[model samples]
Target: MLSDHDFLRYSRQIMLPLCGELGIKTLAKARVVVIGAGGLATVVAPYLVGAGVGYLRLCDDDIVSVSNLPRQWLYSPAHIGQQKVRVMAAQLKALQPAAQVEAIPEYADNSNLCRLMSGADLVLDCSDNMTTRQLVNAYAMDAGVALVSAAAIGLHAQAAAFQPSLCGPHGNHGCYRCLYPIDSQRAGNCQSEGVLGPMVGMAGCYQAALALRILLGDPNVPWSQLWRLDSTLGEHQLLRIQPDPSCSVCGHVSHSNASSDDSSIPNSGV
Candidate 1:
């Protein structure tokens, strides 16, 4: 039951054909967990809260720094040196008082992953590091929760959704590990590679869109597809991906049900 204020607050969204009163209720019933309260989370958390997601759990061990001000819009100059999860949770609560927001100011590892993902309907990977991303992917897949993963470096950004049901049918529907196998060699980090602020925002917006679609149960969304945006070249690419047959993470009979093992990496066909 939406309050009078809620109906008015979400009237425009509810009026849409795909998001009527029922869809709004669904959104209100969905629980989402977001890893890394930085770049992507800045944009994603607000939209989900504004859309009336029932519960939002944010995880991040880092504190707000001056350098993050350009892209992390949730925090202000005054919030510098404050814990990211705490600040973000406060901001989200401010936006939607009716919604529940929790802050976990600790790194999400195997130990806390299960508890973090316990009741979540969906999870968003907004972390910048590959290790954290892989952990989130594995945990979400193991928990049978849908995952929306996004990454950005420089002017390049990629966003994808992984639904457990889509993993077995096609090799294209894979997890982060399938796309980038963990080896001894490490790739570029945001600190070393440098990232454009808008690029992160662009990726974050796409992540939010996918999360909304999953929550609203919109069938038209291609959940297995990956969307790549290269603002540097002014190009956008959409690739339909299938699961990998021999993926280390998703393969093996014992872990056959693990959706995290699926992976696909987007490269510009241009």
Candidate 2:
């Protein structure tokens, strides 16, 4: 049940069809782990907190650089030398005091991925690199947790949601590896290739919206689907992600919910 204060704070969202008092309550108890505190995460954290997510675990070991100021709205020129996680946490708390935000000042690697995501109800892959995305995807499969993965490069962005447990006995749909073959050569990154400032912001907001629908138990938006945005071209598209039976990460789960298609966007950089 929502308190009088919560009802007032989230009245608009509470009135939505799939999201009512029940949804608002779900939001109040969901624990979300965001893997990166960069561009995608910079926008993701605030929206989750503002929307009333119960707990947010922010992990990033990188430091802010003067060049990151343009797209990473959470940071300012004065915070160039600060840790991204701590700075992002402070800002997230300021957005919603009722939310508990933890700042883990370390990168997500094999050694710490499990600990960082031990109790996460949902994992948001707002990370900038494929390595981290792969790690998170593997963890999600093993933990039986849902994941919302997204990435943006130059003018293009792509995102997908995976709910292995929700996919029924067929197992699960494809994952990050299904989209980007693991053994493939590396792709460009923001440092080497330039990315439009708003591109990532658009992707982050899209991911946040999908995440909220999942958190609220809404199936209208659909998981195991891929969405792509071309901000420069002023357009977008949605397609089904084919689950690969050979994928080491999610192979155990079979997903026959929809026809398999190639919906992966080029990995220029994020």
TM-scores for candidates 1 onward, in order:
0.90, 0.89
lDDT string for model 1 (1-270, tens) is 778888898999989998988888999889999998999999999999999898999998999999899989999999999999999999999999988999999887766777877789999999888777877776665666789999888889999998765664343476656666673226555766888899889899999999999899988877767899978789999887656666555543223333332332111110
Per-residue alpha-carbon lDDT of model 2 for 1-270, expressed as tens digits? 688999999999988988888888899899999999999999888998999998999998999999999999999998999999999998888889899999999898767777887789999998888777877776666566789998888998888898866433354456667666663235656766779888888889989999998898886766778899988788898877776766655554333222222222111111
Residue pairs with backbone atoms closer than 3 Å in model 2 (clashes): 170-254, 171-253, 171-254, 172-253, 172-254
Span of ten consecutive residues with least summed lDDT in model 2: 261-270
Off by over 4 Å in 1: 169-172, 183-185, 253-270
Q: What ranges in model 2 sit over 4 Å off?
A: 166-169, 183-185, 253-270
Error of 1 at 98 (Å): 0.8
lDDT of predicted model 1: 0.80
RMSD of 2: 6.1
lDDT of candidate 1 at residue 52, scale 0 to 100: 84
| Shift in Å, residue 74, candidate 2 | 1.0
